[model samples]
Target: GKTQNIYALNYNDKDNDIKISLGLLDTKHNWSGWISPVNGKGTKSDTPNKRWNFNIQKSVDLTNKDEMVFGLQYTKDSMHKTEHNLVNGELNKQSKGNTRSYGLYIQNDHKFDNKWSILSGIRYDNWKVYDSWMQLDKDKSKTIYYPARSDSSFSPKIALQYKIDDESNLFTSWGKAFAAPTLQKMFSGSASSASYTEANPNLNPQTVKTVEIGYKKKFGESTILGVTYYHNDINDLLYTRKTGLGKITYTVNGSTYTKDKQRVENAGTATTNGIELDLNHKINDQWSMFANYMYQQSKIDKCSTNGAAEGKIMTYVPKHVFNLGVDYSAGKWNSELVGSYQSKMYAQDNNSDTAKGVYTAYDPYFVVDFNLTYSMDKNSSISFAVNNLFDKEYYSYNLCEGRNYMLTVDYNF
Candidate 1:
């Protein structure tokens, strides 16, 4: 269960070409679940988070064909979490992790003529962990601490667009992306089957280079179509490695040691090639439809530990996925139906589809949802939705949601 509060305010002065915004967010979550089916015992956890940020943006016209954009932002965030397990009818601390980050960015957009334009941008980030410690009831003397540390990253992107004509356009883009390891990934432990994972604060950010080409066409006011092809080269991809004991190194008491534990690491290099197609059409004011499909192939090129692992498909990358939806609106009623489909996907690295439970390949499935809405007036409406209309049984690493129903009443001011 969760509760959240978010509020923001924006001020704009068109005469000065300036805008300022302020926002705050607070959230709380509580979770309780059985640790195992054998026992009637359970575990519970509570987490609270808060954040505040301010941003200022300015737009300057360098000339008729060029413009510059400036942005400054600052944010503060904090969170604390506690976990407890039923032990003789008492509760005890389990573990906790904390994080903070700051960011700044700027962009430039230049128009060469009516036919071509270019946009470029850069961003900087500083993220750090302030506190992370843990002590389990089973191992009281094994208290662990991840020293406070900060990392900085800089990313840049550029894109270009060309107008083929009034009804069609073409575009290509390239970007460098960065992602720091999350707090939980940096300091957490879990288990599955015969393997277990321990945190590694020495993990580096996952980096990737992406290139894309796309085209879109508008046919009158009734239809729109688009197609895109993309490729991504990923380096230092943060991933888990399941190897023999003593394959990983750790530090303790000012001494270096090796252990046989599953850990997160910059495992290897990967590449992804994909194509996407989408279409939107209006049959009339009362009828509309949209469809999209994607074909993706992702593969690990080389493994840091075993070169034999190369050329294997990346886990969870479905080779095919598609969605189709139709909408109808007439009189005081509106209805929509959407169908989605995905091909089979493996759940583990090294293409080990023989593993049991979640470690095996997940079978393909198709799901459908329908929504109906009735308007009581211009100010209020009622809606009914049926998810998984066919009650398809499926799994994406685990059992997926079954058929469900929902009713909602919405009022507008």
Candidate 2:
């Protein structure tokens, strides 16, 4: 079971073009299930998480062709989890942590002329983690405390656009960004008789540099087409590495156990290049259609821990993807039909799992979906939807969901 609550407040000054916002979120989850299929051991767990957010921004018109905007943002997060064994009714594990982040950014939009425009922005962010610890077992009286860590980064982005005409444009952009490791990736751990994971508090942030170019144009009055190409270079990619196998002693039972230890590390560098194409057409006043396709190649250039993964395709990235959809509307009724396809993908970094249509494997799949809605009046509507209309069987680490149906009614005041 899960419960979530959210609260938000906003203030807008229309005369000055300024906005201020504050938000809070609280969430809780509780569940009990079997932990081991062979032994039929059961366990219960509880997790509670909370977040606080604030933002303030102002927009200023510097000239007839220029605009400037600046903003400041802050966020605080806390998470905790506890698990107990059902058989013995004893504490199995517990983990808790808090994180805080601050951000400042400024952006400008400038038009050199009617045909040329540029947009540029810079952002600075700082992140810190504190008050983090983990307990393995209550009866064993063992605990681990993680040291506090902090890091800061700066990101810059710029884009230039040229309008070929009123109906088409060409644009190019470059940017640099970073992503900090989450609390679960830095502090969470689990252990079994065969394997165990260790938490690492010294992990660094992952960074990427990106470049993109695109063009869009309209054909006649009802058809539009867009195409884009992009490349990315990533550093400090994180991955799990099997450190070694060692003997560990359990104090509660006074027994020794052999287990393989795994830890997360900044393991490799990767690159990705992709191209995307999109098309849209409107047929008369009652029908419209859209289609899109993407081709991508992602590869690990170097890996520090696992040499076998070098030059291999990255995990969970499909080489080709496609989507097509059609929508219709008449009087008080509306309908939509969509279909999507994905090519084969690898599930492991080493790309060793070759058997498809099996557990822990990735397989190519195509699925279709449909939806219909009827407006009862100006204030009410009813909808029916079907997901996975063909009931295709595939694996994405696990088996994907089969065909399903949903009916919903909505009303507005």
Candidate 3:
């Protein structure tokens, strides 16, 4: 176990949001504006971020019952990450890097009567990376420096919706999304000391193109059900690859000065397709139920990862997930129960010799949660909730925190 006081965590965040809507005029003209500013800081262990953003829009009536909306938005952000570690009984990790970005966006939404609608938007983003103060090897005490780099691109999206009736609707969307490498990725040079793994500095931004179609139907008086099918093609999927695990090598300006650098490549490609279903049903005046199900698959198209061949499933992506829950209320009492399940998934490809057998695959698991509430009055209540009711072993986003329980009490007047 690590020592106490060996690490201290500090954090600070401040944010402000403002909005204005002018709705007094006629239907021919209306305007709205929104603005936000955010700032954050942390100790030597986390990243520091700050940003400012604003959006304004105006709607104009074009003829009998149809309207055209025009909108513009701007955002700017700056981020910094400090790298620190202890080495040779001394604090020698004083690396720092930063990134800055600016974006411009425009969007429009139009409605025809009340049966059909369309939405479209486009955005341009530009960003730069600054890297410095990186060490390659402590044994030889070598360091490497990279020049600042910058890139920019455009992303767009379009969606359409049609009302099938008063209780049903159909919609579809095709969109493109982009992400830029963070300052940590750009400055954490590909050098591993005696303790840490090599960090890739040449990492590139990942991108994905997605298409989805869905339909929603409302049945009975208080029940709703919907289903969606989605497919995505991704490029430049970034991942850390462990090269030959031999003695490390370190260099400076093309010369082999130290022997502590591990070779690595930070790029790959992936494709994912999935189907999702959601339902909400009211059993009576005092009881309701909800269910959600998802089936998805991820495949690595290109990579040299362990057991990752041309069309194998990616690591850590479960194929099936289901969640069911119920809520009840009667007079002054209310309660809820929810259960979730996940299907088994492979930790590595089947062909690999070291691969765990099918039976040893990650096991399917279930968890149940419960909540109860008592109304002290019309304007007050006390509630208690317990998560992981059975304390079943499970993982969320690759992390396990064990069973958790909490209690909350509130009063209003």
21-59: candidate 3 lDDT, tens digit per residue: 221111221111112222221112334444444455555
lDDT of 1: 0.78
Model 2 residue 343 lDDT score: 91
Against the unseen true structure, what C-alpha lDDT does each candidate score? 0.78, 0.84, 0.63
RMSD of 2: 4.1
* Best of the two (1, 3) by lDDT: 1
Question: Per-candidate TM vs. native?
Answer: 0.80, 0.85, 0.67
Q: Tell me, by TM-score, which candidate is best.
A: 2
What TM-score would candidate 1 get against the native? 0.80
Candidate 3 lDDT at 374 equals 95
Inter-residue clash pairs, candidate 1: 245-260, 246-259, 246-260
What are the RMSDs of all candidates, in order? Answer: 5.8, 4.1, 12.0
* Clash pairs detected, candidate 2: none
Question: Please, what are the lDDT tens digits per residue for candidate 1 over residues 143-232?
Answer: 677688877778788999999999999999998877778655665554333345776657777888999999999999999999999999
What is candidate 2's lDDT per residue for 41-89, written digit by digit as tens? 6677676788899999999999999999999999998878788777788
